[model samples]
Target: MPRRPSGINDLDLAIYGHIAEGGELTLSEISRLSGRSKGVIFRHLRKLSALGVIEVREVGGVLLASPSRSPRRVIAMGIMRAAEYPYVLGILRGLRDIYGPVRVLVYEDAWREAQDLLSGRIQLAMVPALTALVANRLGGGRVQIIGGGSGGGMGVVRGTGGSGHAVVRTSNTELCAERLGLDGPRSYFGGPGDILGALVSGKVHEGVLWEPYLSMASASGLRVEQCEIEHCCLLSANSGVADQYGKISRIAAAAISSARSADLQAYAKLVDLPVQLVESSVRGYSFHEAPDVAYLERMLDAARRALLPGSSVRDAVVA
Candidate 1:
């Protein structure tokens, strides 16, 4: 039997079912459905939302209810207009949850994150593992992977079940594709989005992508095969913030690891992706601490084999 969510009583479940079936309900609709007074229904609705059994939002001065992941209190994350990291909101929430009113600057590009980290303009950033490793080397040991962000949110794509003349383009997903035996006539693109665009438009038979682009690709009829790489994204802190890196990194790692479907809703408008797409993309991310020793070694090995510009991945990690 499926385990019931805790703190939920029989009454809450019945109320939840009405919202679940109808998609959403206002206080009066739920009241009518349950044959209860509007005042009583409103009270129960508050209880259900507090228990995390349902989501409540306001639209045009009307309260609407729907099914939800057990979301914590929704907080407005003032993500910068240029921010592009899908998980940046979670990082801010993590820091705010721990330090309270901490500062988190966001950027649209990981390379910019690397540049700021090297310049000491920013103390920390969430970047791809290989990017973090290379950036650490580029900064002359000034940067370090203080914590892990997430993994397995990348993949190679090919149409018609990987048959026919495969014109495969690449992105950072190449970091592990070689080790995974993923090889083909390869070209390179600027990033996952460009690669996905080419693939979907039939300009390339294969390409690489990370979510929610990967999700978009699947929805667009492209086949996405996840690469078994555990060193996708990571958290890097520069030497300037080394003193408190441990504390901040732990909180970030925990919060980012626990990032769920509701985080998409809370951050949907900020990210400018469809709430449904972002929420569905959650399954592609497996948030956690740094990659294991072997997986880290594999990514480094692949990075080296690809002739990527960087210092030694081994030296950059600093054990």
Candidate 2:
């Protein structure tokens, strides 16, 4: 069995797994599979279904249960406008359960998040891991990664007519494209929307982006090769906030770190994309409570070759 996340118990997880494996089962079937009494199973089923953590269907006068969607509560939490991160929805849902009423702050891009973090306009922000790294450096190392978010949501697309030209936005993505040997005069955009729009307009041969932009590009008949990139996004806290609100930071970290793929898939509808696209995009992403040093090292090496001025990944990482 997978390790139990905070708040949920081992039995809840077992029941979830059983229902998931069985596709859809009645209370009695789940009880038998779980080796629990029908009444006990029925109670848990009702609770889970009501929470939207599982789907309950009525057919032939019998209730069918399946681990379908996870529960998401509307609550206040602060977040950026970068909707490409699949785990962002999951984390917000999780954080809402903890903090109540997540208040979202939409910035033009991750760079804006970094600026807000430095100016005390935001207490907590989730941006690209590289963005957080650079922000920490810019802020004299006053920000720290309290947890990780989705990674590998970015991709490089070849233009419609198979041109070698390309465009980029994020630093990490630019590095990934360079590492992939996509040689061409690169046009730079400040945001993913511009890059995608340019790609659609035949202005650029290749565009680097994160999903659902990448998925959108592919759906529009453009070829999207998933960047073999990792650690794309991370949750960072201002050092002062982390120091004074450590418990809240931990809660937020635990919530995000515990996000499962099913949570990401369920969130697809919220983002108005096909579940398969969200599913496909996230297969390349990994969520964790801590940064992957190896992946960061690889990314940093690539960043350096692409003319990024970071001395070392370690210099940007929080202890």
**Model 1 bad stretches (over 4 Å):** 1-90, 94-109, 159-171, 180-185, 308-319
Query: Which residue pairs come into collision in candidate 2?
Result: 75-101, 75-102, 76-100, 76-101, 76-102, 76-103, 77-102, 77-103
Candidate with top TM-score is: 2
lDDT of 1 by residue, 27-142 (tens): 77988888888787777788867656578898998889986665432221122221124556656645544323233444434566677777876666666677677777878989
State the C-alpha lDDT per candidate. Answer: 0.61, 0.64
Candidates in order: C-alpha RMSD to true structure:
13.2, 13.5
List clash counts for every candidate, in order: 0, 8
- Candidate 2 per-residue C-alpha lDDT over 23-142 given as tens digits, one digit per residue, 9 for 90 to 100: 788888888888989888888777666555678888998978975564442222234333345556655555544533344565546676677777765667776777777777778977
